[model samples]
Target: MKKDQLYREDYFTCPIYFMDKPEWVKKLNKASDLYIKKAQKNNQPNIKERTKKFGNKGDHGMVHHSTSLINDPKFIDLQEWILATAYNLLDEQGFDLKGYQLFLTEMWVQEFSHLGGGHHTLHTHWNGHMSGFYFLKGSERTSCPVFEDPRPGRQMNLLPEKDKSKVSLATSQIHYKVKPGRLIFFNSYMPHLYTVDNGYEPFRFIHWNIQAIPKGVLNINKE
Candidate 1:
């Protein structure tokens, strides 16, 4: 057979949906400082300084993930509802989970502390077909989620004589100024970057990573 398709059917060229979440503001803020502190302490690094090189391979922000969060009651409580809401939104967008044999395999929160901005990146879950982020906090600035324009080239002004328009096309980074409880979902391969800037307050955020896989294609390993 020919080479398998590089991406699943949902490998998106353009992100499908956006949901405004004003309710989770309080809950996220209440746990924000605690999550950041705990993550820094456990990782044995100053988040402010460590995540400075956010865009490079030596990205320290990547270290905060731990499977133990699955057992924490708080994590479970928040994640349960958060996930339900996300999937509902996805379904409303015409992605039929039942027909596609799709289901979530794992979910977790990523806590980014002072100046903790992700460099340009994309997410690919081990068995996931699609992934997204639930913006908890610290996304108010000009650079919460930046979607890369796939088409990048210079266009010729062919019809310039009749229509007064310059037709030069180039892929520019579109910045999303996100609010406290907004969700952005996209295909795993869509290139994106979380921006970093200088500010007085530490950048605190919680990102929920979701993994969707076809049934019978994945198995749970206790280890």
Candidate 2:
């Protein structure tokens, strides 16, 4: 009789995709700056600030004006590229994108200036299938984003890793260091946050949410 060695299989793994677009980074940065200045002059509120980190209040959540920005010529090309990349990702993940009508539910920009300290608390996006971020500007001093394990209960009993790989480790959270022009996409249910800023400069990024509706589900043509 021959002895058989058992192999471990990974299941229910989290998926994340990253891409780089230098051209879009430049355009987004310029557009973001313009909008930020305009919003400040107009006394627009920053609705996306949840942590209340120290900084110029107007600098955060400036992208809530996504509707207008999307229409702006400065952002149209970048928006189209983001959509195309997202569709490619979905197709690679075995999703038949042709079967559904995809819609962009929300698109926004977040800027965290390290006046003292700035960070976002762990949270998940709602009312969307996917959430993503495109880094318009980043620095080595800026802390990376982290994702928490969705299964908190499973983490109660941890086992030592036989392999030294970070992905194979039984860790509750993982962090990713990103640079300018980097784009990341992940599931909406994944809880994630930006680590505390240790850098002096502002860390800026564009965030967006996507939703897919099956074709003809609403049946509006019959009316």
Candidate 3:
């Protein structure tokens, strides 16, 4: 009885989900090409320098952002899938979503500059309840997502790890090996960032955030 009472139970754990959907890559990538082109302003034939990056690096180290994909017909199927998954995930996690509807609050595609040095700093999507990524292009030679441990208290008095390669509770972060059509979902509060890309290979992904709004909170169709 004493031993049973002393057993440990997991709580406040973070969850991350990923799966491959190769069939969606080709069409989605084709649909997103125009958006990326417009973002980089490369469609103008007369413009020698397309876009500008910070440090006057000539677009070498910057990332291009696309407008919302919410109203795009090409991304409709993906939107449906994401909405269903988010709804199920929250329900499974013990959230009471009875009086709420999941909304695709934000959706967009972004690509790193081809001239190299593209990267993003650590950040969280606090505005939404859940967020995810769907890779349209990537490989071993390209940059990938890095997620940090969500619990800040654990980092305050961390101990040295025996081996950095092996993941243990002491591990502060995890690097996700990315590939085309690989979709990843995580809590909105999770801190994540992308590693710097040398531009040896193309890296592009669709990122979106979902918010659960109470019934009748907003006059919009629920996903």
Candidate 4:
């Protein structure tokens, strides 16, 4: 007699979206260069002291973070597309968004130091429903983003993986290799961070977060 086969179902799965827009790379990078310069200039005094203490190190241990890019005219087109896509993404995930409107809560550009040692600690954006990165400059030699498994139970009761190199149910972390014009989107609650940069290549990217606000809670309309 033949035996019955067991069934399996996957639940609470995580989704990550990405796009490659090579055409927009040059324009956005040009626009953001001004902001990066201003950022480093604004912090020139501190940078000078750091350089003195660090002995002429070529920006190997600092990150230049730009001011809000939400109001910038240069990035308006990209913003509109990203916001609309984020709404559709939520809808595709079966979220009931009829009573809510998605809003761009935050957006900024940041560049890691050139000689290396640039990184961010693992963390999540609790204030937003969606978050993303648009890499203006990066490569295999530069730092990349890494995401951790969000399930507390899975994290607490971990077992050895038969093969850690493969993406299986036992995997607990993920790493993303980035390049210019590469965009990635994921749930805001997922903890993610950048690894140490060896400084072999330039590293720069724009990061943003979007939140869904109920219609009742929003007073003014978005322009």
**Number of the top lDDT candidate:** 4
Position 55, candidate 1: lDDT: 35
What is the alpha-carbon lDDT of model 1 when measured against the actual structure? 0.53
For every candidate structure, what is the RMSD over all alpha carbons to the true structure, in angstroms?
A: 9.6, 4.7, 3.7, 2.4
TM-score of each candidate structure, all chains considered together? 0.59, 0.78, 0.89, 0.93
Clash pairs, model 1 backbone:
none
Candidate 3 has which clashing residue pairs, if any?
none
Cα lDDT of all candidates, in order? 0.53, 0.70, 0.89, 0.91
Residue 50 of candidate 3: its Cα lDDT? Answer: 44
10 residues in a row with least lDDT, candidate 2? 58-67
The clash count of every prediction, one per candidate, is 0, 0, 0, 0
lDDT of 4 by residue, 29-143 (tens): 9999998998777667777887788776656678889999997999999999999999999999999999999989999999988768889999999978999999999999999
Task: For candidate 3, write residues 93-158 as lDDT tens digits.
Answer: 999998998999999999998877889999999778889999999998888999998888887878
lDDT of each residue in 1-223, candidate 2, tens digit only? 3469667777777788887777677767887886655544453434334335554443343222332455567767767776777777777777887867666777766666445355878999887777798887786777578998877677677666665346654766778887898888997888998887865666778888777777777466556
Candidates sorted on TM-score, descending:
4, 3, 2, 1
Worst window of 10 by summed lDDT in candidate 4: 214-223
Query: lDDT (0-100) at residue 157 of candidate 2?
Result: 71
| Model 3 lDDT-worst window of ten | 46-55
Q: Which has the better TM-score: candidate 1, or candidate 3?
A: 3
lDDT tens per residue, model 1, 156-190: 32222342243222333456666667766665545
Per-residue error (Å), model 3, residue 74: 0.8
Model 4 compared with the native: what TM-score?
0.93
